[model samples]
Target: MGYDEVARSVTERGELVLRRRTGTDGPAVLELRANGVFVMDTAEHSSEQALADAALASVEQPRRVLVGGLGLGFTLDRVLGDWRVEHCDVVEIEPALVEWMRDGTVPHGRQLLADRRARVIVADVATAVAEAGPASYDVVLLDVDNGPGQLVHDANAALYDVPFLHVVRRTLAPGGALVVWSAGPAPQLLADLEASFGHAEEQTHEVRLQERDEHYWLYVARPAAGRPEASAAG
Candidate 1:
């Protein structure tokens, strides 16, 4: 069992590397690293799938979706499973990662992007959310960083702040849902979501990976009760 360096790139943030671990012990895994920190891998992504599942279930009609991160394409893949999802916009800050995925460095990258319903935007998610029109999406997912506690980039801390959260809220349609994938039970993040959305709850999901148990949190939030009462998109 060894890791083969498949691709490497240095962005303004730091070093990003993609490695392939192959051996008879199990199926090969593709790992992504940012600034020497483990970001995500193709090992166990039940939580990722759950992130999309929980969001989709919250909304009555899920047509336009925006994914904050494109980690191994797990969350996006799960979102597209629902026939109701007409279009999904994926925002990834790293051009190299998107290139790697689209160019087959990641096994399912091409097939995932090839989906006509999906589009990838190479830009900061915070910027994307802020510039987006009001009530533009039915579902907005944030898997950009691990969590507020563990950040791959120092700048990503803004994503969890109250101002940015308000920006996120503005983009969600009436009755829409926003799900943030966190690595830990970030109490501060939960509070911020509650403050911004007027309705926020923490749902915990556990998964076993590399023979160890790990817990992930999804901070599900909706707009305040006093907002307009438009019906979900048909």
Candidate 2:
């Protein structure tokens, strides 16, 4: 067996990491904390596809959508593949990840980054939602971090909270949907969604990769047409 060149380093939080890039066909793999965490090679992207597919199922005639993370451009690519999606705004905090997509480090990055219908914003997903105009988007999909429970960054915790959920609800058009991708089950997050939205549901799926089998969750929430009945801190 053989492997490509590997670049190893530690993040600010002291998480040991590795990046492996094989031949032209291989996608870069990012390993966190020496646990072989989150392999994002180009072979398969069932989870990303699932995020887009699940969100699209609940939305009707969705024109504009906001994607919280741009990992491997798979979720964005899947959303752009839909003809119903006229415009997409992708927010990613890591400039390097955005540049990777632009420089072809990831396959299909160039095409998706340059598409007129898509706009990539390099900023925090929470701030982006807060600043968005009321009822501006038809769908909001969040795939940042592992999930509400296993957040990669501390700031992301607030995103799943009630106040942020309020902002997200305000940013969506009537009958619009908010979808979040989680590495594991988040019962508290689910309860928060129930308090803010008209209808909320959780979906679980299995992710099969070369090294291991992983289970993930997608929490779908929809805003009510009227105002929120109560306010709860996340």
Candidate 3:
């Protein structure tokens, strides 16, 4: 009934650990780790849900969507609730995380994973996004790291860079949407998105997990339809 006696399990990675702490608040909460780094918990997934909701709202008729992270499958579950989303491809770098979901370590994960409309890809988000054909997805919701400024992995830093932003833009259909979930406000990343897509907006939401007004920023970028025409005088 207390956090001290919580059950713990060490996955094959050996770097990450999962803990389940029972309390009177609700169901048992799950916690994640990576080489002593605290990843996420199940107490509150507001940002994750918001990431999916914001992306779904921007699309006119989104049939296919790409979710860059599988944290607790909250985002995936929210996305699947939308009947308009016919196909959802989730890209998760950690195989253990995927296995945990399939094995029911994370509640509701098995349901979403078992859904015929869902496809779980065990690969880096960047690679998965690159392999996807241009204009292939109506929306892309990314939550791979804490944020651009506080990345879990160094390689993920490029995800917020210009080159990767272009890849995301190309992968989205005309007028398609891209939504990224950050642990906190990322002004530089928002600026990068604006410069790449010519249209971008940020939405801040409160996450009660930390209980200190945790901020999560959602970056929504809409791809342009056509290239600008050259000036006749030029």
Provide the clashing-pair count of each candidate structure: 0, 0, 0
Root-mean-square deviation (CA) per prediction: 3.8, 3.5, 4.3
In model 3, the Cα lDDT at residue 90 comes to: 96
lDDT over C-alpha atoms for residue 70 of model 1: 90
- State the number of backbone clashes in model 1: 0
lDDT of 3: 0.82
lDDT of 1 at 208: 88
- Which scores better on lDDT, 1 or 2? 1
Q: After superposition, how far is residue 129 of candidate 2 from its true place, in Å?
A: 0.9
| Positional deviation of residue 31's Cα in model 2 after best superposition, in angstroms | 7.1
Against the true structure, what is each candidate's TM-score?
A: 0.94, 0.85, 0.89
How would you encode candidate 2's per-residue C-alpha lDDT over 1-234 as one tens digit per residue? 235533343445333333554543444453222234553556557988999999988899789999998877889999999999999999987676677679775556898899899999998898888789888899999988888878667777988888888788878888799999998899998998988886799999998776589888999998766755433243
For residues 1-234, write the lDDT of model 1, one tens digit per residue: 788999999978999999987883778888888999888788888988999999999899999999999988999999999999999999999999899889988879999999999999999998888889999999999999889999999999998888788778878888888999898999998888887788899999999876689899999999877954332120
How does each model score on lDDT? 0.89, 0.79, 0.82
The superposed Cα distance between candidate 2 and the true structure at residue 172, in angstroms, equals 0.4
For model 3, state the Cα shift of residue 168 in Å: 1.0
In candidate 3, what are the lDDT values of residues 108-197, reduced to their tens digit? 678879999999999989999989987889999999888897876777888888888888888887778999888778999889888788
Cα lDDT for residue 230, model 3?
20
